[model samples]
Target: MSATSTVRRFRTLAVPLAVLTVVFLVISLPPYLGLDPAKARLPVPEDVPWFYPALVAHIGFGSIALLTAALQVWPWLRRTHPAVHRWSGRIYLGLGVIPGGVAVLAVAPFGQTGGPTGQVANTMLALLWLATAVAGYRAARARRFGEHREWMVRNVALTFSIVANRPWSMLCIAVFAPEVMGTGPVDPAVLAQAAGVSMWLSWVVNLLVAEYWLHRTRTRRGVRGGPTAKHRQPVPATS
Candidate 1:
């Protein structure tokens, strides 16, 4: 492989690996090492009986979506078996629509922040995730291949928010949590709220970055000639 190709391959592999590693460490290590959920548990929204189910659905399907996304992006796997990639795409869409949609509904009333900001952020995240996936599928069906690719790229980036959220949360905690940063003592509740805000920020930032990258890549390749080239018609000869 050329140097550029090698670098591209490394990047493709490295991003997923880094994302997965961070997510795994955050979910698994933190709970196991020192972070006690009982201590961490803030008051649940009393009015939302469905909160637990929604939380389960959010984390469950979210994790599946993340793993499948990683697999879909694996260079060797995708290059070797296009069928697997396609099948995984279908599954990812299904997961996003059902579990992700339900999770959104659940979040609106029961988000961690438990206020207007949390509700808005979680609702927006859920809607964006669902919209991007539906848009991607529609584009594929309409044979607007470029749009499909762009939409799917955005959808996957949103899904990867599960991976991105923790790192951003940690950064928020470091900045705002005096206990962690060894400044003066700070309110744990305030730090928790800040972390919740960070989660939404991470996903929004990722979506924006993904869209920018997609536009750049598409523009660089010249809209007339990338993977979507076959979708266009030949110019007719002049008389």
Candidate 2:
């Protein structure tokens, strides 16, 4: 490839790879790695018995989404055997539904953020994520390839929130830690709400960036006739 082409490819790969790497490390790491025992923490409320199960389900499904997302982007897996891609896609879709649906249920009664604004934001995010995933699956089933691809991209963007949440949380704490420490520490309740909002916001930003990138790629390829070109030379024009 030309220098320009190489640079373009590098630019295309770098950000997503960095984001994915950070996300994978954060999620895959032991849960206790960054814990501060002195900080205000939200323990699962014993009064609400279902909290533990919901949290477990959320994390489990989030992990499945992350794993399958990484697999979906593998060139060998995606291009070499599309059958495997399709199978994996279906599994990912199925696995996502339960947690995505339950997220809506859990967000409202979220003990950490009980107020109206928090409830509304959490509910909206959950519903939006779930709806996008469902729309992607439906579009795929209907053989609307372009729509399917777009919706799936959006779904994956939402899925990335699972990864983005941690980094955002860390940043929030870092910036506010001194104030928090001085003023009786950050309330776990407020932190949790902020984290949730930040997580969804990260995904939304990623989705917009991905959409722009995909558009630019498609436009460039169209102009160059890169992938869809049949041949360089043309035979005599058909009547």
Candidate 3:
């Protein structure tokens, strides 16, 4: 096979991998969605005034954005049905990002575990999510498609923090399992600090990975034709 064919085959995997990730998140969510404090994975208590409503908004709209982004990233869909892509992008910005990010921003402050660290980390996540989403829309409206795609990439990475945050926190717990399990109950302060560290790490790691990916792709495009190739067309998988 030629080198071009190899690259083509490799690039084809991006959408499928993204689709699988979204599917995994969808399947993983039912356990976290209910009102029962026992069933809720978020540390926010059921008795808390903000928990249920905020949880519903975050889960409901975030799930929409997550699923929509998976489809939006498929090169075939955007290539063949550009209108669908445009409409869905609007949906992604409207019902998906607005309510979803705002819901988390409003609630994360009151509910975060880490005394200061967790609160700050989550607050940043919420702000970055909303800001990137807004920037993506503004870029699209301005017809700066490349900038729009990059902004959307950042937005999606932050949004995926929901999925990434859980596993990260669990890994942190696993690392300290001996100490935590030995104690009758882990101190709330300790739990808070752990959660804060995990939250920061999860979103930061995602953004780093995304920036590296965007940079690598642009480099590849530049190598092909001195940086004009990516500018000539919007990237389908970027959304």
Pairs of residues clashing in candidate 1: none
- Where model 1 places Cα greater than 4 Å from the true spot, the runs are 1-43, 74-80, 179-182, 223-239
lDDT of 1 by residue, 1-239 (tens): 79997777667753756576556746643432333333323354657676655665666676667667766557666677878977887887777455776686676656665245556777887888888888888887876766776787787788777567768878877776747677677776777677667767878999889978866876767765665432454456899
Ranking according to TM-score, highest score first: 3, 1, 2
Worst 10 residues of 1 by lDDT: 31-40
- Give the TM-scores of the predictions, in the order they appear: 0.75, 0.68, 0.81
User: Between 2 and 3, whose lDDT is larger?
Assistant: 3
- The global Cα lDDT (0 to 1) of model 3 is 0.78
Residue 179 of model 1, lDDT score: 76
Instruction: Supply the TM-score for candidate 3.
Output: 0.81
The candidate scoring highest on lDDT is 3
Candidate 2 residue-wise lDDT at 74:
52
Top TM-score prediction, candidate number: 3
Per-residue CA lDDT of model 3 for 1-239, tens digit only, reads 79986666457634664776677677767866665656666676645777767877888888888777766666666777899999988888898988998998877777656557877888888899999998988888878888888898888888788778778988877665435767566676776677788889889999999999999989888887765433666557754
Model 3 root mean square deviation, Cα atoms: 5.4
For candidate 1, the per-residue lDDT at 95 reads 70
Per-candidate Cα lDDT values, in order, are 0.68, 0.62, 0.78
Residue 192, model 1, lDDT? 61
